[model samples]
Target: MPVDIPGPASSVSVQHEPFDVGAEIAAIAAGRPAIGAVASFVGLVRELPGCPGGLSAMTLEHYPGMTDKALEDIVGQARGRWQLQDVRVIHRVGRLAPGDAIVLVVVAAAHRGEAFAACEFIMDYLKTRAPFWKKEETRDGGHWVDARDADDAAAARWDV
Candidate 1:
């Protein structure tokens, strides 16, 4: 499901199509002279280490409305914490092959520090807070992916 946010400064989309990182970053920075820095992260599906036959593919699933709201809230939180100019988050759903892009997050601010910090913070929170389930497929079979302790720890450091 694609959600086009009402404002040009922010948007959250949960889609199956791959996104263009350059275009996304450019769109947010266009005509915005105040934006001095842009930070972005693009997540990709990779082979599972030590898994039999490696990872053939991965599937992501989410509840439409709920997922959008969760992502929007995350973007809002980032905006509240930093003096941001624009933010865009795109998370792909459905089947994805190895090396395929899974998610894209772009943040723009007047300074590099705020842009980088907010970008990292949003990703850390998204890892544990986003209401999405993932299934990894190998030649042997497929299994649901679970939350990781490292991810939780990453988010915890930013806690108030």
Candidate 2:
């Protein structure tokens, strides 16, 4: 019951296996010549900011139905606000080490403004609205990560 939505304009997937970012980007506008801009963002697991000796690894968990619905809602909102021609979202789960890819957002539009804004808007909402939980493995042991105020601020700026 993983969150994988297949559609002509929008695609979303939550998978444990790695994905090819390049191929994903290319597929968004494989045959469509109308797309003028393709904006994308890739999030990665990095060393925990406050960890003493740095993070060893991080694990992500999510409820299948809830996570998918939240992501779809975010994308739906973006589509309404912007003139996005295509959108793609991919999130990874389970054990992930620092430097590993965590999420990918791609948006295609007739102009750079719409594509860029839509990409960021979707990611911002996904950060705040998505049900994914994170746990970090540090020298002290595993600890459930807390929501960051910055993430809230990022999502809040959109005013969506």
Candidate 3:
């Protein structure tokens, strides 16, 4: 299912190859006169202790139907809360190296504040609400990365 706003153009895809942040930002702003500012964020895998040597690779998994719906809901909330021109979110799944890009978020608006706030809001919501799970491969073995309670707290701050 496609997740996009009703009036503005948006693109969301799951890809294995590394995403070009510059290109995606350009695409979001191209030919869009209403968009005066674009905000973006890219998350990368990091090496963390606790599992043998460190994280060598990570795999992301999601429940097919629920994942898309959750992402759409997040985008919808951003639209309702801000005057955004467009939004895009792309998350990668499968084996990824330590430096690989995990997800990308972009928001466009007529002003910088709305674009920035909405972009951060979507990212915070995704960290907690998205149905995706991460499994890290360390020197010892593989284990599912537990979601932190702090992430949930961060998302809750936006709620009225």
lDDT of each: 0.89, 0.88, 0.84
- Residues 91-139 of candidate 3 have per-residue lDDT tens digits of 8877899888999999999999999999999999999988889998888
What is the model-wide C-alpha lDDT for candidate 2? 0.88
Q: Distance (Å) between predicted and true CA of 35, model 2?
A: 0.5
Residues 34-105 of candidate 2: C-alpha lDDT, one tens digit per residue: 999999999999886877878999999998887777887889999999998888889999999999999999
Between candidates 2 and 3, the TM-score winner: 2
Q: Using lDDT as the measure, which candidate wins?
A: 1
Provide C-alpha RMSD values for all models, in order: 1.7, 1.8, 3.3
The 10 consecutive residues of candidate 2 with the worst lDDT sum are 1-10
TM-score of 1: 0.94
TM-scores of the models, in the given order? 0.94, 0.92, 0.89
Candidate 1 C-alpha lDDT tens digits along 1-160: 4544445554988887789998888888999999999999999998888896899899998887888888989999999999998899999999999999999999999999999999999999999888889999889898999889999999999993
